[model samples]
Target: MTNPLFYAKILLFGEYGIIEDSQGLTLPYSFYKGALKFSSLDSEFEKKSNTHLTKYADYLLDLELPKGFELDVQKFQYEISEGLFFDSNIPQGYGVGSSGALVAAIFERYSITKYNPENISKDQLKNLKKVFGLMESYFHGRSSGIDPLICYMNLPILIENKESVDKVAIPESEEGKGAIFLIDSGMTGETGPMVQIFFEKMKTEGFRKTLKEEFIRYNNACIEAFLKKDMNPFFRNLKKLSNWAYEHFRPMIPESIFNVWKKGLDSNAYYLKLCGSGGGGYILGFTKDYEKAEKMLDGFHKEVIYRF
Candidate 1:
């Protein structure tokens, strides 16, 4: 049987704000993807993945899943013994759902009660998020489960709140010069520590207030404007969101990309924001003029994911 492929994801908005029940928008990023495969474990990559899967299988065996949701852990263990490894090109720690894809692959293959992504309802989507949260927590210590859910459904999801999430339709890409892109930060980011920092920041009344009143407002507005194809409002809100991140998310921003983030705001050519937890990995960028933004961001690597 051919292994099913799982794609990477990008959380366009609502990074830390989601924990506080703010709205979020996430979409599949197909440029990088992964799949489950059996290998001889000869190559170092295969051997390492096999070892990790062994440990992950052990973890799954002890996990207490929600009622009616269970993994065939015995089969998973047997497959690990048979040199089952995740064959993926998604970059780990890039905030693009590498581990999430792996988790989705495991669930798709081993779940006792299968839920077809195409036929799932809103309630089922919520339950899937809860299950994915429990499963993906092994990697991040705490998880919102958005990453794995996106990978599993392979669809754009809009989070209305903690208990309300549904599939969403986005504007189709166009041949225009504007674009949504990713910029390589040239370093890997650890989600756990960055999340820790965000939690610590939450302790401050001022920061929490700003996040709710400013950050989330801009985030949700951007999502709404983008969906309606209101470019003016979208870019306006995006600029605000990008500026807010620069001012408040300083700790999460990697030092190397600090200047580049500021350069965008200053030049008005493009706006940049966190692709995930920041501190490294890929930084998301939006530009009304991709060519100008490309020229401004000359030294850094960039890939346009959506054009308008």
Candidate 2:
């Protein structure tokens, strides 16, 4: 039997800003996905995955299981023994929610109370986030559960603030000149250290003021404009947000791409932002013209995610 597939995700906006209650928008990126399967041949990768899964299962077993949450530990162990492994292509540390897919797969297969994304109540969603967050914290040191949430739901989620999140509709992809794309930074990003840097910066009053006054305002405007399909306002706010990130979140941006990022703003050909934690990983890009942006960004890899 073919197990379910969980797709990767991109947090289009709101990297560290979300921690300060800035609005965020996340969507599943089906181009990359993962699934759980039995490795009949038990190859090295499969064996490694099985071993990791066993350890994870053991960790879960030690937890004081919460009410209404049940994991069939024995069954999970049996599956691991049978060489069950996560077969995935999502790149770890690229900020595309690799572990998130694994967490979603585990929750779906093992959780007795299967919570369907469709029509799930806000309370149920909140509970699910807590569960996934705790489970994923093993990998990230800390987690907001947003990554796994997007993978689990496979839907676009609009984060109103730190407190409220709900599935939201986005403008339909259309054939047009403007596009959203991902650019490979040619390096992987670690979430924990990058997060630590953000927290350290938050210690300053200046950083706090910039986060609340400038970052959140533009972020909220970008989300609202994007959802409304108001491209002019979306790009306008996006440019400001991009500028803020460039000015303030320099540590998060890959050192190699600083010139490329600034070139976009200078030329107005494209704008770049963090796809995830942004120490390295993939850098997200937006452009009014893909062809022109490609010309401007020669010698780099680019993948078009959505066109408008």
Let me know the TM-score candidate 1 reaches against the reference structure: 0.99
Model 1 segments beyond 4 Å from truth? Answer: none
Over 122-158, each residue of candidate 1 has an lDDT whose tens digit, in order, gives 9999999999999999999999889999999999999
Residue-level lDDT tens digits of model 2 in 112-140: 88777898877777777778888888889
TM-score winner among the candidates? 1
lDDT of 1: 0.94
Clashing pairs in 2: none
Q: Assess every candidate by TM-score.
A: 0.99, 0.97
Best by lDDT: 1
lDDT of 2: 0.89
